[model samples]
Target: MNINKKTQTNDEGPEDSNVHGFTSESVVVSNRVPERSTKVASYLDCSVYARACGIETMRQWFDYHRVKEGGKPRPPGIPGDPSHQYREVWKGWPQFLGTNNVASAHLSDTAMSLTDAKAWFIKNEIQTVKQFRVLCTEGLRPPTIPACPEKFYNVKYSELLAPKSGRYLGFHEARNFVHSFEFNDYLEFRAYKRNNPEMFEKIPSSPDRVYMKSSPPEWTSWPDFLGYNRITRTRLEE
Candidate 1:
């Protein structure tokens, strides 16, 4: 039989303590990779690295070494164009673009927050494109208005899917602020007590207080959200 013994230490903290004859303070960081001048690698899930290598920013190196020898450079999108090709691409662009932007915040060259990412979509005219797409999805043609200062706008897929992407707080955490309501839960609780006095202690607490102030989200009601296949909707043309 084996027994694990424990010891008492100073009041410092776990960071300052050593136990079971092991010490984290004794560890040292090292970069001693076995170096091979040119390492072979597979070309999958590494487009970003390939993209870096393909960049011809310096011009001369690209002009001399790399040419369009890799058979048409990249595969084409959907053969021929559809009216909603851009929309379809826009909806799935993130999936096609991979999770690179998701890691942009951690990259040294670029810094992006959720706010910055939202701003980028607006800056790149994606909101207008997304609104057009969503409108098309509803079989509604894009409206061409000369000028209406009060009614001009666009929508972004990211902002449309808020909460998940950090645009707005989801309702589960903000139900109390949306509205107020009255219920009969407490009445039922009282009736139960009167019917079974001996079981009063076994009765559960009334849920009336929990949803007394419950309400739906301030935004328009979400419809067919899951049915939309992850593509989102917005007030831009709803």
Candidate 2:
């Protein structure tokens, strides 16, 4: 582990004849020949010995000298290479979408919305929107989102929807916007109605337009009211 930082002088002209133990100095000379080492070293001095001894030796050497320290712990084994255990644990972990399943599909959609937001922000020079999109989506673009442009508002929604834009809106953004509109509860209640119109017609609407009391009536127990059972009946009727 005897590593030396070699320094070269301008006048040295790339070659030196003066040599010492594991060290050399260069001097400017027109006919200097490259030095070759012919002496054999012990097993302890070989690179194979170093690798066989493992990266612990390197870590200890680094830690003792306070060189390039303080980051996430490097995986064990060769300093730059991952250990077998590291590979086994992260074998299927998705790098782009976090998971390799249905949730990844949803996240991919969220990424598209963020990409649009980013494009709009860059085009308008809206710093806040740009920052928000960056924070929400992380740095990398998701598969469903378009490639981010240098400037925003340069592209139109029509362009985005076009085949050339190669991007699409995701369900997560749609759900978020709908929730922001304060229509989530209504949408949830009417979800079944959308699938079965006849059964939806059978379930009676609230007698009072607004339930202002401290405790609202339990619609599930009311026979004519729309509830889980009514929704199920609609599905069955279908």
Candidate 3:
């Protein structure tokens, strides 16, 4: 059954027309295939003809006739699949349309690996997933970069993209460095931290909070951690 190339302004329906089982009425007719069928016709009115052609959607039926008449198949990502703009048509044909699977298996296989992606992010100064997504939205992301790497790679993107510094020191090592200062209390420790911003970058800002459980056995409290003799100080003050 070939869809007619011309429009039908006459009152004659599909039965009277030379067109096998299709008409331009209520259906978009393209040189190849129409984009989609009109919702004006109820499903019952369109389903029989659609089923007879072995096509599920109105667009499929039109494509079948169009091809039968020697029109080529529409290009990929155009009229073949429902896009974000086709949500209205998608609702009516839930079984055949509106699939949300955007991640392409081919792209996933060919795109940059997670290790390379992290290095690229660091080089480009992209430290957050939100920034990466914004770049993807703006079409600034490279073809090698996966749009949703966490979804594609099954790992947390934030942790993978975290900025790594060579100067970073572990809790115990940083505490050892702080103990060399012999600070009297938290105030003195804060004063030193304020003065030496570069040193604090290597150390945790709040050791009390960061190393609560992980601190070494010598870690009794903030005073002890800072090498402050609180007992001796209290005795001297009294």
| Candidate 1, 208-234: lDDT as tens digits | 222221232233222211112124432
Candidate 3 residues 1-238, lDDT tens each? Answer: 2222345476554442222343445332334332344433333323323432345433443456466687455422233323223434333331332222233546667778776776677667676766765565455777677655665566776534634444446656776788777677888888888899986777656666444323122345786567656767531211
**List of clashing residue pairs for candidate 1:** none
Q: RMSD in Å for candidate 3, one decimal? A: 14.6
The best candidate in terms of lDDT:
3
Q: Clash number for every model?
A: 0, 3, 0
lDDT of 2 at 158: 30
Give candidate 2 regions above 4 Å deviation: 1-69, 72-102, 113-115, 118-238
Per-model TM against the reference: 0.19, 0.16, 0.33
Which candidate wins on TM-score? 3
For 113-218, candidate 2 gives per-residue lDDT tens digits of 5345434434433334344344323534434443332222245433322111112122233223223323224445456446665644433232122111102222
In Å, residue 66's CA in model 1 sits off its true spot by 14
Task: Provide the overall lDDT of each model, using Cα atoms, as 2-decimal numbers.
Answer: 0.28, 0.30, 0.51
Model 1 worst lDDT window (10 residues): 142-151
**lDDT at 12 for candidate 2?**
45
Ten contiguous residues with the weakest lDDT in model 3: 92-101
Q: Is 1 or 3 the stronger prediction by TM-score?
A: 3
